[model samples]
Target: MNDTFTEADLAPDPQEKRDRLLAVADRVAALVAVLAGGVYIGGMIALGAGAAPIVFSMLPRSIAGDVMGAIFARFDAVALGAALAVLAAEVTRMVAARRRGRTILSRLRRSCTLFMAVCAAYVALSLSPRINDLHRQGVQRDDTPQGQVLEAVHKRAELFGKIGMGMAFGLVVLSVFTIQPRRAEDEEDDDEAAAPLPPGPRDD
Candidate 1:
């Protein structure tokens, strides 16, 4: 019997090829989302930690207030962009999984992504400007009812930013867990495909 093998014989099935392509795309998207989340969190940390010393020690109060405002505005812009990118990637992954009839995708991840995006938008568009305005007012009028209001706004914005960063980190952790299972499943499938079938008993 001829036992010659051709490239056609070794070629992957079309559906399997497509599935693998989609799996790779999903993995790439997840990685991007994680990276963006990291950027978002890192920027928040820098805004809180690095900017403070510069604002307080290196500059006068008026200049410091303006500098801090500009710094926060820029940080918010970058963080908002990163959050939106992560949200888009996560939504695309969810839609692709649903289209592929995959039941392994976690709904919690989607919820977290949505929440993070909303929080980021709110902070960037609304809270950031309000906080800057209050900072200016506090610098101008430090011992009045308006100053008390400034303190309140400061506390609220700080809490919201903290919550948003926490959500971003949570999404990263969830993505890691979700993708790990898929990686293991892919490896197991590859191993099974490579394993040889046992020989059947020969007929006499």
Candidate 2:
């Protein structure tokens, strides 16, 4: 008995498979980054758009502070988790890309993602605690000089949080664009390949 297999019958090349998997992973990272950005932007907007102030004014100040603080804590928790996931995914993609042949764009993207992740971590862990401490002290005795200083510090931290969040949002947008398939390049290649054959010499 004789057996024969054609090219289509053979398994895909291992390297080709690896390349496809890496591409899929990169796409997933891009998607996660975009979704995480949306979540973060929404939470930031809710906090910055006077939602806390409105709620505080409607209730006893103490109760308002506690509730708002709890809400912010929950937001921070979610933000931190999401940021970690994004960072891990981005790092994985960067390493994979470098193994192949790192481009300038890939390096820039990795740096941007790392900076965004660090910003998110700092905001959640360090800045949040400082803001909370300052707010608590200010609210306890805001008429006093110490309380006034506390209030100023809280405001400054809040400003920093806004700037950090804005940067993170921008970086996420850039990453999304960076990971998108180069459709224009692909189209150009196709057009070149499909160009009409030059007119053949007419038969005598």
Best by lDDT: 1
Off by over 4 Å in 2: 1-5, 8-11, 60-62, 99-105, 134-143, 180-204
Tell me the tens digit of each residue's lDDT in model 2 across 131-194: 5775565453267876676567557657756765775677577667667353464467569779
Best by TM-score: 1
Local error of candidate 2 at 159, Å? 2.1
Candidate 1 lDDT over 81-199, as tens digits, reads 98889988887677656554344446677777887888888888988798687776554335678766666666677787888888888888877766624546568768988996679
Candidate 1 — what's its lDDT?
A: 0.76
Query: Each model's C-alpha lDDT?
Result: 0.76, 0.69
lDDT of 2 at 71: 76
The count of residue-pair clashes in candidate 1 stands at 0
Worst 10 residues of 2 by lDDT: 95-104
